[model samples]
Target: MSPSLTCTSLSFAWPDGTAVFDGLDAAFGPGRTGLVGVNGSGKSTLLKLIAGELAPADGAVRVAGEIGYLPQNVTLDTALRVDEALGVAARRAALHAIEAGNAAEEHFETLGDDWDVEERALAALGELGLGHLGLDRSVGEVSGGESVLLRLAALLLVRPDVLLLDEPTNNLDLYARRRLYSAVAAWPGVLVVVSHDRELLDLVDQIADLRAGEITWYGGNYSAYEEAVAVEQEAAGRMVRVAEADFRKQKRELADAQVKLARRKRYGQKMWDSKREPKIVMGARKRAAQESAGKHRIMHEEKLAEARERLDEAVEAVRDDDEIRVDLPYTAVPPGRGVLTLRDLELAYGARVQGTLELHGPERVALVGRNGAGKSTLLRTIAGELTPVAGEAAAHVPLRFLPQRLDVLDGELTVAENVARFAPGAANNRIRARLARFLFRGARADQRAATLSGGERFRAALAALMLAEPAPQLLLLDEPTNNLDMASVRQLTTALESYEGALVVAGHDLPFLSSLGITRWLLMEGRELRETTPEALGKPV
Candidate 1:
């Protein structure tokens, strides 16, 4: 039978009493599912609940078979050997002992019928592109990306019927990510992954969008999900327009009815004052007119209320994902103006960047390389945060560097305050106004940076850097899309679209880099910088 996972009446709240999910029910069966949501929509929390890492406040999770889970941040003991991490050292030892003619009863018992356990373990590691890592090698010998792959390799060796992975490609390089993608595509059981990686999401059989503590299932892959959402939004917009028209018509009719009633009252009073009829007959007529006016007013009021309710329902159907809108004329550079120059730069870490490089005007550059190929180091050197060990790295114009950690913003300060610190000479009101364009309007601008979600923090940091004094004609971003949701990644792209400055961004996300209209592509390898195209980089290294 195919594996299955089900959750019923699931509810959870954080220790601080912030409710994330309430009475949420979802089910998955025999397919690869991609769980997606905004930054603080509790994607990770839901995965944890399914994996039994955290108990739900109410309801239960049911699984048809064994499960394996890989979290966003994986920690492995540095001293652990590869075989030990894969949970096969003891079994392998027992098999070896039995083969060596020391057939102790305990050794035979341990070996059981699985004498090929070592081979299976090796095969799992090889599938994950870690074949070179021997069974005896320590975890410390591997890089961060390799470590993540190693953990995944361990999970694969278990051969569970259900697999759960959370942001599995966050630290993986392009090659490593491709390996993970292959594994995900070949899985034969129920698999659910929560990730912002577009390529990874494209491999899913379906999308489970978690928004407002509810799951909305979309058939097919990420592209299909996007298309479906766009169509829904279009329909919703049409409904809103129709509702608005109806509301206006109702208001107009109500106003006209009131005016008519007022005119009738005036006419009746004039007749009564003139004594045009008998006293009793005039009194009866006046009472009838007053009752009719009251009824007309009540009917119009009811119609208006119904129109408003329809308008509210239509508006609710529309999504409210805000985009960053800003005019950065000060950041604009004139044609042929030099922004940065690097001449045979050598980083402090012994990485050599050969030859001279120059960026002029509003050129956009994409820096691509393996994990330790000095892309971040080169960006830091250009930003003047690090001095090159040999040749010179200089920026002719004002530049700002946004590191992967996003440590540019002060945690204790409000978003507006952080912007103010960077643009010291700008007036407070002006700073707040600029922040509103970045989607932090009024009260939102006053939110402390420490309390912001991943996406919000990124926006705040970008605002601070772009709105800084002297207007940063050159911008340097290191792995800017790392740890960001797809929505946040799109937001970053929108913000960059408004920036008229020279940009150098180091990232492994090819799609995002392509969206930025990168004018130049530089590959960092062998401690040297070589110009390459996106197509060339996609080929075997």
Candidate 2:
């Protein structure tokens, strides 16, 4: 089958002269394709080009049919009604005019053959778990997750031939994500999604890996792609080992040849001193020896150069993914000390705590809830960023909160400077040393926070929070993995492993929460909290 989308010799560069793609070619056929890459690799830019939201500086983006795009961030005007947001307000108005016996040719034309447009719109909304939403309801009344579903519903209503979704699951809760997965599974036309959600990637027919302005296709889903990459990396590592051994052998041979030449030169000098033969014969012997030595030296040098080239090629084949190394023993909490306590707490949003509760030691707690369930409000209240309506939410030790928006970082400040603000007493050298563990080595720590990518910003924010002067005996994180790539997520997991503080993380990412070694699971539902098991939480509400 022919590809639904194709790019030929595509080239694009930002106004700042940073080139994103050059002489790049790619094709996406009629199937679901998951486009994945590390942060700053331009996955979203490629999607935009395909959707006509962006134009390439050179070459073209060819599409077989109509396109629908859902961007990473979906913003709706507060005044927009549900029907207006779905692009059916005019048709609905025309239908109402006809029903009231005031039909005009223009109204009929506006209605066209979509007499059931309203019903179809409602059905589409229902399919996306928005059945409870009224067509006349204001957009401001819906939650963030609902807005994402509403945008997707609009796209589905259009039924475009090629669908593009960039981080579609960014604000979606578990139930919303399941609805999206079903829609993706049922999609029959070309679908290309730029996302870091592993579960969403698992439903795709193939994986498109974008790196260094090039694309490489792998059959099957994310797991299969990972397996293939692992095998390839293993082979590359073996090749590197072989090349290094060959390089060492070549160097040893070169050194041995040099030593032999030096010994011969010394022996020739001794023979000349002893006057063992005629001067002409001795001189001829010396000249021949010098010529032979030159040849040997040139041959050995050539071999060594070739070996070095082989080693470089072999090394290039291996992938380089840096990991964060964090050590914060000072953040550890004593086993018997109370880290947090909640007594008859009533959140600002009216979510109530059933009874008194206490957390001690370095307990890791997972807070799971549906969207609009006040998870964020509860976390904010616990962090002292919000006030409870009726009761007390107290933290007995120094703590830090990493919210989903990552607003803890000051955009105008350098990464190291931001960390220093949080760690007032820490010396510059000490702050720089800790920042290095977060992968901001040397000059990288001096980069402005606004210039950092999503992943880099996350690391910088985490470093600031963890390396604070008070040592954060309790850490509260709200959906920390929302937009992070898989590599960044793994790095976060690694960094959290070294943290000895009490943790209460509110997130819908089950795999990530599980990896944090959570000892307790709390479910927020109907304005109350209940302790539960991971297995129980895995089930649908």
Candidate 3:
């Protein structure tokens, strides 16, 4: 495939002088490319540079054809009509005017040679699962996920030769994500997407991993990338072991040389004091001994230095996969202990729970639903953050709620201070000791919450909720994995694995929910909650 988009010697930095990319070079051809990396690896920044949304501090971006870009956050004008948002309002109007017997030259010019604008636009919308949203409908009438699809549909209608999407699946439901995945898989033009969606990435032709301001290309999709990385890590581990052995051997040799040199110096001094030989002869012997000892020491020292350098390099080659380890014995709920109960619960949006629903012990529940299905409302009601319109929703055990927006954290406070607020009266040292397990170490815990990246913010919020005082025995999370990169999601899974509590997580991510060991699956549909099975999720359990 020939290249359609390319960045040469690209460099960018925030106004605070924090460098994101320095002298980076990348290219994308007429095939889907998944750009992936950790939270702060500058994946989105690179996309913005390619899309011309951000000006690079140096170098240039070259594109062979027109480019379309979808940003991480899609915010359309709520008052705009769907047709206007799709960039076809004027063309459609011209076609309508021509149909109404107004043969104005301007209308003809606007209509152009391709006259199937409306049909094509509708088709694009339908392909993205937004067909129900008619051209006249206001943007505000749709949900967040619908808005995302709508924007994507607009981009598709433009038919740009190159497309740049930044975390395009951030708020999409499973069905919507599938639609997007299909569109990406079918894209014939150059496509470069920065995302954490595994399924979406798996649809791509290749994976571009951004790390430390550089991009490493992999031959296939995310699964292939993982397998390749695993092999590389294993080899790197062996190199580390070899380097360590070499370092230790060099240290031993240096120690032995130092010992011999010291003994020879002592013997020479004693011989000189005893005057065993002539003074001139003793002096020459001492000089020669000193030169030989110096050379030997230098050689051993140089070898030790080289060995240490090799060890350091080997260690750096291995990936850091440290998992959070914490004991939450206080959060345990014994069997038969009621955690929560809902009786004829009616949420604010008219969504209701049918019959009596009871949660006991440390049961893990997966709350799966489409966008605008009132999942968040139900969770809020259960957490007592929102009162039900009618009927009862009660929690017998202490509970904490982690909303999708992650507003639980105080942006003005440092990460440590936020945890301290949650665990009131707890010692700062103890709070920091626990925060370290969450990957916030030393000065990192002192970083203001406002300065954290999307992934970092989620981790801090999760840490606060899990480490809160009174030890919540029931945790209600609303879309807990939203905006989290794969690594952060793994860390969350590790952290939750240690929690001995009841969990009700409302999310569309089936893989994440499955990883949590969900014992029960609840589907929220038609204004009611119904029991479902893992097999019904359409993915292998």
Candidate 4:
């Protein structure tokens, strides 16, 4: 009834606080507000702050109604059953019994005619395309997509007035994703979703660009935001160019005048002989004095001052353009045929087969698959991490593997030690420099491998991979963008695309993979690996 939520001058940070939001202000009434930003800009933190579970260092957030938050990673208390987790028939009686205190008592009374938790859960699950799931199944045993769907269903069951979702579609299949979008589109409550999925943004009415400790409102969807931002960026660029040009012109004039003065000074005494007469000396002095202090001279001084002001404004207005580094190197490999190839390879887990796998790599190939499809097991077989049940995985080229988790690095050793151990013969300085490029600079490079965030750890693993004399001919990546923010993902993508060798990576970020133009794909169904197109395997994350 009242405004759904209100936030004013809200600012927050940790004790050793990274000042995330500073004097932030916004309001959420009854519409979709899409939150967009590069990774680590504090989108998640802001959501938590608004939910009141997290306190802000400054300002306030007041909510008038109940809210539901769905984080990207849904931690299903693995011990809970599907029916238990879904609040199926088993939980409805309790939900209704608790409804004695609710404002929507009439609606509950109408619906409470039956303890139809299964039917209700089914209806919600159907909306997320997850109705087919067995009610008795364990939530722990469910697939990533299913768990995600269950969470969505749970959120809907409560029917909160405000929904805050982080990567809401992380566990959805294509159809499920579409359904989620449809639900969001039809919903009357306030919705705030933080996601990189462009398709999802289409349903949102506005975008809140969260960056540098503030939220900037942009009307309409992602496209409109892009267009408007483009114009703003162009304007900034124009200002910079104008300022630089004026500055350069003034500087050039100043240099020219100084040169002229120098030339006259050098020639004045000689050309106009003072010894010839007092008149000649007086003439030279008069010429020099007039040139030194006229309006033109004053104008040059004014121009210099104006130029500096323009330069400062230009610097202040420009925003950094997004750039990523793949750090591709041309480490020669034995020029040969396929190092690893999948020919009509099929993948399935216990006969619930998905798609086919069709891919080959001669260099450092990354074997990628979704959560259950056994990306890790595939990598293991190739690197002897696991034994493949059916398909023959042949590694024709010499290679090293970096798992999603850097199990290779011992926890006790510092990064330098890990580097030295694996990359034996490399100097400490070289290791430090390589680590620095990935943001592990200075003393930070000495941090134990256990201390790194998911992204930082991955970078360190990459650094370790490159430390060898002959870099691996193939690289295998699994959900490389999982923990890295969009910006870091962009950089990693850039480096991987330009990488001289071969690759196999499994990821939900289809837009990103397509941009890199992956050569092949191995679609994972249940346990089977079958040949497929890059287009078919991606989940449109």
Candidate 5:
């Protein structure tokens, strides 16, 4: 296939001299490509480089046509009108002027051939589930998910031949996500998406596994990619087992050869000491024995070396899926232990709850809601970060809240230092030993928080939260998987599996929530917080 976008010998590094990519080459042909990797594997960075958001340190990116990029973090000026944010304000104004009987050449020039720009823009917005929004409405009026859709609608209006989206579904609710999915399914150009959203990846034409600064293409969607990788890992494991057996066999053979040589030497020494044969005959026999032993030793050693090399190569072929193995006994709550309570609460941004809400024991709750529906506000209220206007929102047990932005860590501090702050009075060695479980081993634990990638930062923040001194019995996580890759998401689920606390995670990731073994589902609407199931939400658990 001919590539619509290509990178040749691309290189990039942070200002701190941490190299992300070096002499990397990638090509995206005319199809939807799901770019996947572990956190900090440079998937997002590569998208930025290809989209011209970040300048490469070396080589170049070549595109066959116009490109559109939706960044992971979409920030729009709140004061701008929807049309302006969509890059259609000028064109729309010119069209309106011409329709109002203004025959000016400047208006015609500005309008160009897109006399139906207004209609097209609105159609794009409506297609993205923003039909209620008007071109004159301010961006601040829309929710985060709506804003993302608006940006995507703008990209669609321009009709770029190559589109790059980095975590495009991060802020989207189920309704908005479905809209985005439809758009992705309909996309005809070269679409490269760096996302942890499995549902989004399922729509892609192929999967690109980015690992250690290289791209390995898989010939289908996420599921196909997963199956392919499982097969590869199985083969790699078998090779490792075979190599290990050969290595052991070589060791045994070498040891046996040494033993035989030693016995022969001793026998010859004994014969020489006795002077059983004539002096010249004994001397020649000893010389021949020494040469024979040397050659035998060299042969065994060579065979052992080859075996070891095979073992090393086989081991290197296997993938590393390091997990967060943590045990927080203190965080565990016995059954029926009251953890949190909300009574007739009135939250910030004017969301009201009329009834009492209670959380007990180690209940895992999944909070699902639309963007701007006060999920974060509810979590903040439970965490005591927001003051409720009416009734109290209280947590009886010690609680910790991890927000979407992951602002728990101090940027200036190292990972170890940050964890130390969370776990005061804990020994330095203990903190590091625990940090290793979070996959920040040795020098990685010494890395500054500011220098870490999105995944590393999330892991560091999670370590601090889970390793806090009080060992929080109630954990509130808001969109915990926002910037995390699929692997990081799995690691998070593993970590949460060991967490014996009550969890109230506010996120749109249904698969991740299902993996957590949620015991309750809470849906947040304008003024109602009700118990609902995945079926009621029209999604699988």
Candidate 6:
């Protein structure tokens, strides 16, 4: 098979010369590959480099043929209809033959024997649950998630030899994600997927852990990589501990030798003062002392080399663990069993349809539906951001809403500033410490909120909520895992699980909600949040 994308000593750095990853080298072959890393550890940036969307500071990203890249942020221009934009890619390719003169055989080959690109595009769109949108439906009428799906459908119809996807499953629900993975897995091309979905990662042939400008290859899928990483980490720790122990022993031995040498010299001096320095062999005795010192020096040199070797391994074994710690401080318990009550709740904006919503008690409910579904609106109504047009929405305690879009955070202030702004009465030092707990310590704590990623923004907003004098008794989250990687998602999940405050979340990711052990599900459709399942919540295809 022809070689796919190749990166020879790929090096890239920011404008300030801060290295993202340097001396990086990897080749993506014709099989599925997963790129794993923490947030800001160069996963997405590397994807961009591979797709030729971002030029590296040094080194090259070479690809075999035409590449189709689907970015995490899916954008569709309003000028073009969904079908028009998608078909345009394949259409333009076919048009190339008509514009230029070529041999008949080659020309026929360039434009596939049977001209059915439109049909192919429509079929792909159907697979992605976008068939309902007609050939002339405007992209501006589409939801964000629908736009993302359209982009993928377009990419599939283009049939590029190289496929690069960054977080394709981010906003997709369980059914949608399954559909996407199935479609991608069937593609006959080089697939390089950068994602945090464990189920998705299991489909890849190899896993590349990008950290500190290096990619360590691990055969098999993410599960296998996890096993190997565990073993390697244990071995590294052992080597480091052994080196430290040996160094300590060597230091003790060196001290003992020095003391012995010093004592021997003093004894020799005493003998000389007593006029008994080897009796008639004084010159020989002095020579013997000099030889003994030379042996001691050689021993020290040997010990020095041993110490250097140990130090080298110790340094090399150092590894980094990127952990996100969110310490949520719960407010005093409300004098009520059920915190939020929604009964036949109906919400909508103007002509948008919202079905009836019914929720009750302190149960941790997962509000799930499609992108344009009334999930966010339901959360806003619960948080008093929007009043229901009909039906009742009531809560026993103060409810804090963390919107999926994260408009709750002020983009102008630093993380610390935002936290303090939200919880003004928290002790200054306590606020700073809280910021540090959320992985925004030092300059990160002082960073402008505008520069934060989707993950950091959520963390900052959560940190502020956690520090509230009386933490909102009920925490309402709307798609909390949108931009977070797998590890970060786990971190957030762990933090939320530990929270005593009740949680009412509206999320699209089944893997995440399932992982969190969410039992209750309120599926949304139109303007209604109804009890539903994976199959019944499907968007019209």
Runs in model 5 with CA error above 4 Å?
1-3, 14-18, 266-290, 539-541
RMSD of each: 1.7, 2.1, 1.7, 6.0, 2.5, 4.8
lDDT of each: 0.92, 0.92, 0.90, 0.69, 0.91, 0.76
- Candidate 3's C-alpha lDDT? 0.90
Query: Which residues of candidate 1, in runs, are more than 4 Å off?
Result: 272-275
TM-score of each: 0.96, 0.94, 0.97, 0.76, 0.93, 0.84
Summarize candidate 5's per-residue lDDT along 50-148 as a digit string, tens digits: 888899999899999899999988999999999999999998999888889998999999989997888899999999989899899999998878889
* Candidate 5 similarity to native, TM-score: 0.93
184-212: candidate 4 lDDT, tens digit per residue: 89878899998877667777999998878
lDDT of 2 by residue, 29-98 (tens): 8999999988889999998887778889999988888889999999999899999999999999999999
Number of backbone-clashing residue pairs for each candidate, in the order shown: 0, 0, 0, 36, 0, 8
Instruction: Give lDDT: candidate 4, residue 379.
Output: 63
* Candidate numbers sorted by TM-score from highest down: 3, 1, 2, 5, 6, 4
**Candidate with maximal TM-score:** 3
Q: What is the TM-score (0 to 1) of candidate 2? A: 0.94
What 10-residue stretch in candidate 6 is worst by lDDT?
350-359
